[model samples]
Target: MAAPITAALLIIGDEILSGRTKDKNIGYIAEYLTGVGIDLCEVRIVPDVEDEIVAALNSLRQRYTYLFTTGGIGPTHDDITADAVARAFGVGIDHDPRAVAMLRERYQPHELNEARLRMARIPDGADLIENPISKAPGFKIGNVFVMAGVPAIMQSMLDTIAPTLQTGARMLAETIEAEGLAEGNYAAGLADIASAHPGVSIGSYPSFSTSGFRNQIVVRGRDPVAVARAVAAVQDLLHRLKSDGVPH
Candidate 1:
């Protein structure tokens, strides 16, 4: 049987929930997963606590085809992702020699301290995910991929892993910008269009101009043919609006 292409994100940290940091990874991950045809079912944010991490790990990993965890893997006092994964999986976490060796090669003798190598710990039988920006590698335990929290590093890691992921057809998006129209005026028509095309995601974004509000109706779907047809219909609807030609 083919492995299912469903995924979930476990964002771990106290900083995120406490509002010390705004979680940027969730949005990026959602977009990335959508692009790769993996349906992102859920997003959970847990504190740096071990028990909390363990619970989230167990729940998400078991439920989703692929579980991606962010944060709590740094070389700091708070980093608890490795230990949590071990507990969740009913296994032991050990400092892998390969990870240690990589760290040794990257850092100067004095720089590679014991605390810095805290990232070397990995669950038994897990594979390491490549980290180009920083030598501290992320690892995969079964279907769970542990990645960095930082946007740049996370993006790089995602790029490396994305090619190996199974993705369906790319989603097609059609956007037509209308010069002058209030969102309220088009909301009903957009709702009708949205209902007509169940598979398509239609949106109306309104922007203000010198004249008045301008609405851009965007329609998107996985099927290109359906999107194109919907887009033409939207254009035809817009043409009938019969706007007053105000001199610029």
Candidate 2:
């Protein structure tokens, strides 16, 4: 099998860090990447500081197959992600004619002030990611994709770049509802099954409601046969425990 495609997300903005703006992009991006068979390995939220953004950008870009950054590529003084990305990659940054043209479609010549033109500044040699909503393009330099902070625009940008990304083997999963079974009753058995199936991952999720505890065991793996084997073992263990009249 080919090596797994991995990615990391760097969320940049003081508003996110300060709780001024709640984040909705992380979960969306995670699910989207998962569907495309790219594992999102890590996520980091950093302030608007250029140095901090540069450090995180350099670190994550080197560590993962791809690094996606959202927030800080806007029209304000605090929007410094482009500059930091250029700095991290040791490249020059300036207003790209393509980006400026895209922005001009939404903003009139007179309305294209310095603040708004800030959105046109892109890293050298980077490909522009079209923004269908606002027309202020995102950019891809090296393995890093710099996107907008706004959730809607960020999602659109992700959609635009989806076709270009590399994907690995799709992860398969099976869920066994252990409704009347408590996790403590099956932890050891689950561990044994997990050890038996080294290629698969087994996890138990328990939720509490007024009635009692509801447990769900999830088996996941890149190999479908491995996942199925693990799921069967977990089901057998749960069935045996229930037959023995183990209490929830």
Candidate 3:
């Protein structure tokens, strides 16, 4: 079987770090990539500093099949994502005619001031990712994709880039709820099952709510058969634990 395609996300914004702006793009992008057969393997949140963005961009873009960056591409003064992306690739960035034309469709000549024109900048040799909601275009350079921070715009850009991405086998997943069972009780058994099925990934997640505490075991893999086998093993482990009256 072919190896799974992987991607990483770099979320850049001072507002996110400062808790001024809440992030809503990560989950959306993760589901979108998963549905399209690309695994989102890693995610990083960085401040709006140019150096930090450039460093993170360089690191992630090289390590993963694709690197997606969100935030820091707006028209504001702190929107330095484009410049940082150019520096990372050692490429020249300027107001691209294509991006300018796209922006022009939304903004009149008099309204296209210096601040708004900043949205037209594109890195050299990069392809523009279309934005249906807003006129500002995202860009793709090498394996790195730069997009907006706003969830609506980011989702739109993702749709635009989806066709261009090289996808692998779509990952399959199974979820089993071990209600009234604690993760610690199944940790060892889950480790053994994961070891036996090397192709599948097993994870135990515990959640506490106003009603009570519950644990859910999720098994994921590229192969449906492997995932099913892992899920069955997990169920069997849980059944034995329940029968043994193991402490929850």
Candidate 4:
């Protein structure tokens, strides 16, 4: 079987760290990558600082099959992602005719000021990723994809780039709920089951609501048969605990 395709996310902007603007892209991107058979292994949120962005980009792009960045590509002064990306790749960056053409569709000659023209600057040898919603285009250089900060525009860019990415075997998951059960009671047994099934990943999540406490065990694996075996093991463990009159 081919190795699992993996990716990382780099979220850029001061507003996200300051909590001035809540981030709505990470979860969406995670789910989207999962559906297309790409595992999102890591995520990092960095400020608008060029060095920070460059460092994170260099690390993630080399560590994974793809590195997706969101935010910091805008008309404002703080949007330095393009420059950082260029520096990270040791490439020259300038106003690209293709990007400028795309922007021209939305902005007239008089409207395209210096600040607004900042959107047209792209790294050397990078391919443009179309933005259907806004005329401004995103660029992909090597394994890194630089997208807009706005949720809508980022999502649109993802759709445009999805077809170009190579995918791996899709991960399968099974969820078993342990009603009125506490995680501590089943923690040891879950660990044992996980050790037995090296191919599967098992996680236990606990939640408390006004009604009471509830626990859920999720098993994920690329092999459906292995996932099923892990699920059965978990269920059997739960049954044995219940038979022992263990308080949930």
For model 3, give the RMSD to the true fold: 1.3
Whole-model lDDT, model 2: 0.94
Q: Per-candidate TM vs. native?
A: 0.85, 0.97, 0.95, 0.98
TM-score between candidate 2 and the true structure: 0.97
TM-score of 1: 0.85
Which prediction has more favorable TM-score, 1 or 3? Answer: 3
Candidate 4, residues 1-248, lDDT tens digits: the string is: 68999999999999999999999999999999999999999999999999999999999999999999999889999999999999999999999999999999999899999998999999999999999988989999999999998999999999999999999999898999987568989999999999999999999988888988878999999998899999999999999998889996
In model 3, residue pairs whose N, Cα or C atoms come closer than 3 Å (at least 3 residues apart or on different chains), thus clashing, are none
**Root-mean-square deviation of every model:** 3.5, 1.0, 1.3, 0.8
Query: Model 4: number of clashes?
Result: 1
State the displacement of the C-alpha of residue 137, model 2, in Å, after optimal TM-score superposition.
0.6
Candidate that beats the other on TM-score, 1 or 4, i.e. the better one: 4
Predicted candidate 1 versus true structure: per-residue lDDT over 8-55, tens digit per residue: 999999999999998889999999998778878899999999999988
Clashes (backbone N, CA, C under 3 Å), per candidate, total: 0, 0, 0, 1
Off by over 4 Å in 3: none
- Candidate 1 contains a number of clashing pairs equal to 0
lDDT tens per residue, model 3, 138-169? 99999999999999899888888899999999
Residue 216's C-alpha lDDT in candidate 3? 92
